[model samples]
Target: MKVGAIVTRIIRQMVRDKRSLALLLFAPLLILTLTWLVLDQESSDLKIATIDVPDSIITTLNDQQINVIDIDKPKSALKNSEIDAIIETAGNSLRITIDDSEPTNSQAIMMKIQQALVSKANVQQVEINHLYGLELSTTFDYVGPVLIGYFAFFFVFLVGGISFLREKSQGTMERLFATPIKSWEIVAGYIIGFGLFAIIQSFIVVLFAVYALGVPLEGSFWNVVLITLLLALAALTLGTLLSTFAKNEFQMMQFIPVVVVPQAFFSGLFNLENAPLWVEWIGNFMPMYYGAEALKEIMIKGNSIDAVVLEIAALIGFSLVFFVLNLGTLAGYRK
Candidate 1:
């Protein structure tokens, strides 16, 4: 009878939390639906540019379901990522230059090209070159930058949101409201206080990823750190803003499925190139997408900060917007 009474009380408590109940029932289904949308879509066509290649080779490539486009500047197209590869005749041999920024796409292009050549009689010698990756680069090398950005974002978001929520739940926010502090000042103080630790965390994560894990640092180390710090700030501001809506830590955690999980899917970790237009559109709104893209540009492609200015700008923009929203949310507590 005692155990039954305790169980009944716990059940009543759970039923009273409508948000938690809804999250428990619907979060998994939402994630599964997103997974299906990403994984079930047809892959985008593989486009290869051919310059002065034989008609037989082009026809073979087409037969193998690769799109072959005739172009005069195969090098430019490959560099611009306009095409996956460039195939051209170099004397008696055919030279294939692949954009190795994305190893999966490069591997796919290589497989299709080899299959096409093998099916044709008297296959010419093929010379392969990578645009960015080394011959020894692994899948980790391709994904490490994205992982760095993701971890930085994830930890900062989780810590900042929970910390801010704790302050509210503990009545610290109520005490502050009794002071002369403006709502924006409170938001600014929280960002600066949390941001110091976020900066430290970003540096630690980048250093470990590059040195301990042997992730290649093709670009300047500071560039990687800069992107990670910006991403962290974005996460910090976003977390504090969202925390205003959450009544407690449990509700803060509920934001994970709704906020963080979708960013993981939309971030460069998964290839959304072949997904529906709407799916890619959803990625546009995600700050992590820009963060991951900038990290890749610096780490993988060895590009300068100038090359990723747009992505950096996007991250700053997200931070500013979230900071403003945090200020607005704090206004409710002022009353």
Candidate 2:
């Protein structure tokens, strides 16, 4: 009888929280659906334009299992980043200018072209020029640093935001204020605690991405570490600052889609060729835009530190702005 009564009470309590029930049952499904949509899919067909190719070569290309589009001008197609590679036949030799924005596509196109010419006894050497990615390695290599920074930023943001929110919700913040704590002191303490964690987290995440995931780290590892720490600090400060406006943990969670999602759209994940002029400007306002760009340069281009000074400066500026805003927001909690 006692066990039955306890079970009934537990069921009643769970039933009362409709939101909790819905989140428990539906959130995992939604996440898995999105993951499948993005990462677990097969490679899309690579579209390429052949310009002035010989009749024999064209016939061989047509025989291959690939999408071939006959384009009027090679310049237009390449400029638009449409075609993966342009095959132009001048006499017996083929001149290939590959849209090397993505390394995998570049490699695939090169391999296919070679296979198409395999039967020819006099295989002319094709000159290959990469449009975006130079003599670099993998396509995933470019996104490595950016992904590391993003994961660090995201995790710290959620953890810090919720921690600060809990302090307010549990009335611990009020108790602290009643004692000798100043608003800035409380903010500083939170920053230090979270900031230390951010440093360690950034190091581990970057190292894992570079060494374990085989994401290229052409630049100095310390520079990557410094940039990741700065980015995480920016996220931490932004999270704590935003938490001031949030009434509860649910409200804090709402900020993710609003503030974080748009950044990804501009962060080099998708080719932004079709984006509007205004949309391009929106990227200039985002911190991730600079971070992703610099990260790409460092990892893929093996660019020197001087090459990314502007981006590093912009990231520091973002951190400063968020820190100042955080300090201002904490004034609200002051007695």
Candidate 3:
């Protein structure tokens, strides 16, 4: 019950972990900067593509400094996310085909296109069509996919990270290393085993959100599950790998701000694209950014696997990188 002895031990432990001390002090600020840069930046002008309209329409949009692209296959482009909206004519009727995956953006695009058409000539009427999402869909529907992925990653990361940290702190890692199991085998087994639970968690969370909470599930539920499971794999592998850096559960929690929070900020939950050139490039490295995009495409856009193949590949790539890194890091615990 010596007070001095307890205080000295605490100070010694904190001093012993130089990396954890640095992470605790600076990681929050770094995450805050990224989040603020993304969430605080103003949105850019909408991207517009003209289909079979007149030269005057494209000229008007280009004149407005809007991102205007003249494309031959407007429908394919919109589906492929090549363009935000298309300006066309249907039997002399002016029609605007919008990629309505984001309702707010769709509204803005519609307003801009209307202004463009009005400025051109006498606008009698205009037809509006949605390539994906409903004009009536709420913000909840738009961000629901991100929420689902965030929650899935959040819980899985905590469980996976803490579980591995416990094994390390409790000396089970060294005991397992004492056996003949290769590092990759241990890593693979952890992924395959914990991945089963992660998949089930994804299913429950998605089902509850869509069916119980009435969040819009415009696309196939299976697609949502696929993207979500991939996201979980990335989180699981990342958590286990990062555990190599943490000495205990508190240090593992330290990763939450740096690893999890930044991803949520850029995961399309908030559209902060003003500093797009660099900030958007930063988001490319986050695993959840890809998952959120894929989920939005499937849950709201009703897009299939082909439409979001790039995002899927990104998530898979993240998982693979973290998986390999986990193996490499695990070698430190054993050989």
- Predicted model with the maximum TM-score: 2
TM-score of each: 0.65, 0.66, 0.63
TM-score of 2: 0.66
Candidate 1 backbone collisions, by pair:
none
Span of ten consecutive residues with least summed lDDT in model 1: 24-33
Instruction: Identify the superior model by TM-score, candidate 1 or candidate 3.
Output: 1
- Clashes (backbone N, CA, C under 3 Å), per candidate, total 0, 0, 0
Residue by residue across 1-335, what tens digits does model 1's lDDT show? 33343335434543675654333333333433344344332224878998788898898899988999766687887888888898888998888999999766887777778878977768854455568745323456666788788777877788778777877999988986887667776677667766766667677777767776666688999999999999989998999999999999999999999999889898887888899999899888999999999998888889999999999999999999999888887886678
Residue 139 CA displacement from its true place in model 1, Å? 1.6
The sequence of per-residue lDDT tens digits that candidate 3 reaches over residues 265-300 is 889988876766788888999999899999988887
**Candidate 2: residue 51 lDDT (0-100):** 74
Q: Model 2: which residue pairs collide?
A: none
Q: The CA-based lDDT of model 2 is what?
A: 0.70
User: What ordering of candidates by TM-score runs from best to worst?
Assistant: 2, 1, 3
Task: Point out the higher-scoring one by lDDT: 1 or 3.
Answer: 1
Q: lDDT: which is higher, 1 or 2? A: 1
Runs of candidate 3 exceeding 4 Å displacement = 1-129, 133-135
Residue range with the least summed lDDT across 10 consecutive positions in model 2: 24-33
After superposing candidate 2, which stretches have Cα over 4 Å from the reference?
1-107, 114-126, 130-139
Using lDDT as the measure, name the better of candidate 2 and candidate 3.
Answer: 3
Number of the top-ranking candidate, with lDDT as the measure:
1
Write down the lDDT that model 1 would get: 0.78
